[model samples]
Target chain A: MIVGDLSRRELADRLAGEGLALQFGPFNLRIRSNLGSFASLAHQLYEPYPLPEPAAISDFHVDISAPRGLRRWLRRQACFGIDGQLPFAPYTIEHAFPALEWGINWCVATRAHHLLLLHSAAVERNGRAIVFPASPGDGKSTLCTALIHSGWRLLSDEFGIVRPEDGMLLPIPRLIPLKNQSIEVIRKFRPEAIIGPSFLETRKGTVAHVRPPVESIRRAQEPARPRWLVFPRWVAGAPFTLEAMPKSQAFLSVATNAFNYEVLDEIAFRLVTEMVRSCDAYSLVYSDLDDAVNALDKLSQASDG
Target chain B: MLVSPLADRLIWQEWDDIYIVYQPAAAATHVFNETTVLILKCLQQGPLSMEVLRHQTEAALGVSQDELAANDFEFATTRLEELGLVEFVDDPSTAQ
Candidate 1:
């Protein structure tokens, strides 16, 4: 069963009561929200993901609700809490869905110590994956979004969940939030893309999200062995340029860019060491999506040959 | 200065001129640049006076001793000392 199977009223009833349990890649997430806006958008966007069994255990239990008392009427806000703990402050009601999106990232970044989690984007092609570990505003999401839309499979848009036992990247294809100018860039680029409502003037300026392709959502359980590590940066008016990066330099960048590398320590060290040794690394600067995608395609194709 | 017992327990890998050493005592991985790598390699040969270590490091780097300041050698050794990876057996404060 999927979210789409449930009618609007049925989904609302479930959310208003217990929660809606859904499988997101490797984990089961049980989401509860009193905000009707969040439910509607969630239903529309998460339609492709499968529903978890009612008896199965959930990895995360989160809730988003409008606070009661004067604040509800004075200025509406949506609060995200997990297991009775509020991780961050409330978002204005208009940004309720975006709040839910960011809340999911917070949960994984803070928890999931069992996996070597990286602040990165992972995309796959022909069993080979490229992990782009980068800081925010470095065009990680933009490049990931473009690649996934341009025939590459979206392993993940935000979290690079690396299984420590083996260096394979576990797929956790979630929504890609395109901020400000990139929103129009993607909208014009991929008309067929399923996009959620734009939340304007929130924390990240005007923001919109592009849904993960249905195929990626359906094939969420499949993990890919990484073959490349590309750090992408968006440079306006600059031509597409890809330079080979040293494995040692790549190792340092990946270790520092990870969300919890120090917490995992030795295990993290071994995984990164092994991963960097096996994969080719590059630094990419680009302005145009078409040219960038072509260059990446050529890179993978050369490796395949 | 001689490498400490903790330094002997270091888990590390070298790629080209770069080396990343993980000190189990500090639970910290240190990434050493070329000069630090040269200094570490020189110290790995056994205990040496500051003058000897500096000469060996400069020789390996192919830079004349009179040209470059021995700052990197001082920096690397100072860092190694702070991390308990090395210790001064002869009180280098008195050394020129």
Candidate 2:
């Protein structure tokens, strides 16, 4: 049964007990959290994801619970637990969803070394994926959310998992976290976009998550061959420009942006080299989302032809 | 004379003139330009003196020994050593 099939009470009961196993891209995560806000957000946001059967093996098991010690009673907070260890400090109860989101990303980034994990956004169209490897504040997620709403499938918003054996990009398809002004930008860009409540004064500054499209969630298992690697940066009032990036520069950019590039070592190098070699690399700067999306659409078409 | 060794677990790939070396033992990847890679390739054979490396690199790349700056070669070798790509080793002949 899909996660949407469970009633909110049922979902909460399962989460508060043995946990709820949900399929996320290629991995199945068993999440246990008693945080009421997290449960509500899951019911609202993860409506399209399939629920893993009771007997399914989970790749990572995590829990979110009330923090203990003097801080628990003094200023009540939530702590994320992974395999009996708390990897991060507690956050206020209002920021539970972001904490959970980040915790899941941490799990994949730190433990999943079998695949090359890039700190980037990935989207697919016409059976080909485009990877955006950029430093923070580069407007990757904003552009990614725009493209997804414009018809591209969201492969991932934070991590791009590339399988070394076949050079395929795995889809994580989780929430697209929007920070600060980008949240308002996306909200206005796509009026129908369902974004979670914004958590202000957090580490990332007014962070919210845009729910993944149902189609993306349904097609999470399908991997796409990478066709383009674009390093995008948004500058206000700037004319859109797309420039070719040298393969050598692209190689270093990708390696530097990868989360587990060092851990995967030889395989990571081979895979990233193959990826940069096969795809057209570019540096994209744009102010308008529509213009940016249109340029990418044309590029994808040119690639096909 | 400077002599260094390439790690055993390294896997090398060439893109144009750039070389990408993947060191599996350390789980680290390093990119080297053609000159740096050529020097490393020479070191892969065995330890070589600085003078020997100069002549070998000059011959391998068809460049004049006079045109090859000694400081640049020394700097590159030192950088490679810093990256753990190569290490100084005692020459058996020198010991004898």
How much TM-score does chain B earn in each model? 0.73, 0.82
Positional deviation of A68 in candidate 2, in angstroms?
A: 4.9
Candidates 1 onward: DockQ, in order: 0.54, 0.53
Residue by residue across A1-305, what tens digits does model 2's lDDT show? 78899999999998999898999998899889888878998898888889877788999999888876788789868888899899888888888888888999999999999899999999999999999999999999999999999899999989989988898999999988899999999989999999988899987899998998889989999999989999999999999999998888899999999998777767778899899989989999999998999999999888779
Q: Per-residue CA lDDT of candidate 1, range A1-305, in tens?
A: 98899988888888878999989888899889998988888878888789998898999999888987898998899999898788888889999888888898899999989999988999999999999998888888888988888889999988888999898999998889989888888888788887888899988898899998888988899999999999999989998899999988999999998989999988888889888999999999999988889999999899889
**Which DockQ value does candidate 2 get?**
0.53
Model 2 Cα displacement at A196 (Å)?
1.9
lDDT of all predictions: 0.86, 0.88
- Per-candidate TM vs. native? 0.92, 0.91
Could you tally the backbone clashes for each prediction?
0, 1
